[model samples]
Target: MASSDHYFYVLQCADNTLYAGYTTDPIRRLAQHNNGTGAKYTRLLKRHPMRMIHLEHFSEKSPAMQAEYAFKQLSKPQKLRYLTEHSSEWLPK
Candidate 1:
């Protein structure tokens, strides 16, 4: 795979909750969440995921997973701040 394949992403679900995850394609992963074939938590929520709100591209799965862990450790407010600050840098055009 290419160096741009890994991605650490955050999604804003229909219920206003955010979910952090790592994937090779954020868009496709979001689609999977919406289609109920993604994470077990998202699948159990039964709420359609709205979109990928933030993401950090990585060249390796380990790095992406590390980013995901760091993101998940942040409080909701901190996560929101991170998304707000990095929104322009990560979100797809």
Candidate 2:
């Protein structure tokens, strides 16, 4: 089976709140979110210029989506903690 380079990502929105979702291209997805053409929830928030704070690569869309759902379930503080812990791992190196 071909491996999926799908990624589950977390964004720190303009309002400083976190949002989670899966994508094949986080940079483009984030651009869409900032442009008010992404998720309906984000579109209605009057927020923009979203910043990507976390990213996790998965082998398939299904698992990436599952990770997205699980990440979304985290409380804000918990999410922040996760971000802090994982930040260095995904940074350009």
Candidate 3:
């Protein structure tokens, strides 16, 4: 069996706002967000069918949450730059 690790992910809402969060299962969590069963931030925004734009893996919840919080603190331009440069497609170091 695979060991569980937390993941920090960035989602692009319909209005193009970025939302950061941590989850053990990105796919299921994305589904929840789309179905309006996820975070109140996403749900209340009425930004359904969100698209995942980035993801980072962490061995523990603390680091995962820390990543989410850090991403959330970034300004829009900084967030966009971070996504463009540190995209999940590049893979983690």
Candidate 4:
């Protein structure tokens, strides 16, 4: 796969919660979450995910997982800030 195929993503659940994950394919991963086939955290959410709020691409899985790790350690407010500050400006809001 190309370097750009790896991604670190942030998802907003239906209940106003967030989930961070690393994936090679965002669309397929999002579908897995919606279908209850992703991470336990997402699968156990009160409802299906609302949308993916942010994504950061990586050339390797290690850095992508590192991003996911770092994102997970942030407080909710900080996470939101990280997303806004880190996401590409051209990405849809």
On residues 1-93, what C-alpha lDDT tens digit does candidate 3 reach at each position?
A: 544689999988877677889999999999999888898888865576688888888888888999989888999888877887989552221
Per-residue lDDT for 1-93 in model 2, tens only?
Answer: 654689998877677777888889888899899888999868855567677878889878898999888878888778777777877643321
Q: Which stretches of candidate 1 lie over 4 Å from their true place?
A: 1-4, 89-93
- Tens-place lDDT per residue, model 4, 1-93, is 366668999888888788899999999999999999998888875857548888888888899999999999999889878877887542333
Error of 2 at 89 (Å): 8.2
lDDT of 3 at 6: 92
lDDT of 1 by residue, 16-66 (tens): 788999898777888899888898878965467467778788888899999
TM-score, one value per model: 0.83, 0.82, 0.84, 0.84
Q: Considering only N, C-alpha and C atoms within 3 Å, which residue pairs clash in candidate 2?
A: none
Which ranking of candidates, highest lDDT first? 4, 3, 1, 2
Q: State the local distance difference test value for candidate 3.
A: 0.83
How far is 8's C-alpha from truth in model 4 (Å)?
0.3
State the local distance difference test value for candidate 2.
0.79
Q: Report the Cα lDDT for residue 23, model 4.
A: 97
Stretch of 10 with least lDDT, candidate 2? 84-93
Off by over 4 Å in 3: 1-3, 44-46, 88-93
